[model samples]
Target chain A: MTTNILLITLVVLAIIALNTQKLRRAVVYLGVFSLISSFLYLLYGAPDVAIAEAVIGTTITTVLYLVALKKYQVFTIYFCSDPNDPNRRNLTNNSPFINNLESFLIKQEMEPQIIYSEKPLKTILTQDKFDLAICQTNQKTLIYGSVDDYQLDALEDYLLTNHGDLNIHLIRYTEGDDNEA
Target chain B: MTDNSEIITRMTGLLYPFILLFGFYIIINGHASPGGGFQGGAVLAAVFITRYLVDPNRCIQLKTLKTAEKILFVCIILYPTFFLFSTSASHTELMNLIYLIAMNFLIGLKVCSGFTIIFFRFVFYEGGIL
Candidate 1:
């Protein structure tokens, strides 16, 4: 009886928290929602949904938001605000490779930065946020790099797809914001 | 150094069932409402983590684990987000629910895969004698 009431109460509170202007708070609320929703699922005899809520609803979403926050400063404003705002700038516009970074990396050509890394591994490494660590393990040439989870993920395709020479092991701990392992 | 069973063995014996229960709860409740695969998988993964912690020497090989995660993560992002915009209906309620479910599933996949990877990275990567 009380469990149901408490659950409903929590859902209401989480909804309120999510509506706030601050991005971090919203992420927090979403986390709360995930936790509570899991409990609710348990109450309603839906163990499956409860587990998903706890894991997916709570953890991953928060990590994604936090990652985005750490990288982009959380955007601070809701995405829908101010269409005519001139100050907003797109950071991804300046890229030397195909289309944008994803396509450039996807097409199996070394990035311009990769070419630049020919100087000194450390010197070229300073040019961008990502750093490569090349090695020959078991005669299978490997080029590991330092990148965020997203970029690491982008690099993942190159790995599993059997890219002939590149066995990448992204060391995610190298750069800023390293909460995740 | 400390008596091994005093801390870990007891904990594993005690904690295993609850963790399993938690995972089951997440899975069964998923489709009709909030939770789903990723969340459930994560809970299941947590059990492995718990097991690994208690006994570091044991090998936990979750085969085809990464692939499943990738598929789920991709589905979560592309499917749900796309559906959010694509499905235009008069009820608006149904659309909202669909979007929410899609998003949840994506999250579930990502969580499951991520936990699995983390297991490899931290717990099991070095192989024996932690």
Candidate 2:
């Protein structure tokens, strides 16, 4: 009876974990589900698999979460045209930030036109629409087309939070350099 | 993190060993029924894991895991190899059982050590086997 309850609980929690959009919550619930499943495996007398599930499902996953979390502080944002102010919610942090907003907009589904630039020494930001021009560098200035300001701001904030983009050369990937503004 | 019920927490702490034994029992009786070495060993490891959870610093003893793992690996391989060479007809029931146990033990050791090593190397990174 208790075993059945465990199974049912695991199944429900697993469903919730899979469907949840929150990354941290998903990881936490997934860890619990894995640990419970390991318990069930013990009840059913499958030790080898139980061990693997326990380690991989629980410990490794928790580690993955911690490591990834250390790398980022995820923020949500979306792109839309609003010329007056592109980068909204300027997170008051002095650290350099990597702008992921433009790329988010130009994701595989967006099919953005990539433009290039001629000047190579320094880098700057310009905009076509309400989308913010996230200046990225990797030994060269990369202008990844136009991204919605909302998305760009979130990306920059994330970079700032992680303390990245200092003393690192920014590299840009887009269509061509002619559109450098 | 103690739970709501002091009795339950105390009981669980006390009963953890038995829970481990239960797993071990399943393992030892694996061949007789539907289980084998891997199952049994995992149960043993579970004891350590449980201990660790209950007291993070106290889960697996690094020295014990290393020494036992080395000895277990040697035995699993040596037993199987000896059987393969010496026994003209290892297809016999006794031989089959022995071989199964050996293989099961090896599987358990590998799984436990491998997971621990990976976790220690990539995740923990401070202590454990460097």
Candidate 3:
């Protein structure tokens, strides 16, 4: 009877974990599942297996999952390009820089969401908050990022080292300036 | 990641020694008790994990861990084989117990290092610290 209860609880936890939209909540549910499963293992008279299960399942796996989730956080990048620019027409679907940037973000384990905007740079900057904003003019590319973002420093360094040939300028917006503008 | 609460740091410092003692006890008395190599190693790994939680940016010496794991793994394989081949007749109970204890210790070391390596890799590389 006790085993049956534990098994049913495990099933319920698994289902709830699967159904949860939030990844963190799902991790928590999985932790609960592991805990119950460990208890079940103990009930089955395999104390050694139960100990292993309890340790690996409840602690190590949960921490690993949490770290992975943190690593693969969504990185929102907004691209605002001037429609009238002649370079815009040439850069329509095949922008090598954008592709490279996306690949770089992926390499860093970030899920990059690139939003192409027909609106002006100032309007996009002042309106919606973003991790990064790229403004493409005829001659140069302006990369606007918040000074508070720790990743921006790495991104800037990467741009300077890897894409030195490209006319890319990195602009950092301070916390005070962000609210005023 | 470097910055953590004072309470966490204090609690970890207070509990770490006891945890290590318990893990060692589990590993040493594994044959006579419910716990064994994997369980004890997992418990040992929890100590590192707790330290990581207190300070996520803690630098782990992977080279040392890898070397230790390799040595333990080699011992786990070679020791049993040596004992099996060297013994002409059936082994005594004392010999068997010694063999089991030694194997358990090696396994515990291997598992502990392996898990610690995994944790460090995940934190350093996948955690986007670089």
User: How many clashes show up in model 2?
Assistant: 18
**lDDT digits (tens) for residues A1-181 of candidate 3:** 9999889998888999888867789999999898889898888898889888888899999988887777657787888877777667566586888888888887876778888889988887788867798987766779998886667777888888877877889998764123111
Which lDDT tens digits does candidate 2 get at residues A100-129? Answer: 433543441222322322332134233232
The CAPRI class of candidate 2 is incorrect
Model 3 stretches astray by more than 4 angstroms: A83-181, B1-3, B127-130
Pull out the clashing pairs in model 3: none
Q: Estimate candidate 3's alpha-carbon lDDT, on a 0 to 1 scale.
A: 0.84
TM-score of each candidate structure, all chains considered together: 0.33, 0.44, 0.68
lDDT string for model 3 (B28-49, tens) is 9999999989899999999999
**Can you write out model 2's per-residue Cα lDDT over B26-100, one digit (the tens) per residue?**
665666665455545554555544443354444345566667667777776687777778967547877687777
For model 2 the TM-score comes to 0.44
TM-score of 1: 0.33
Best by lDDT: 3
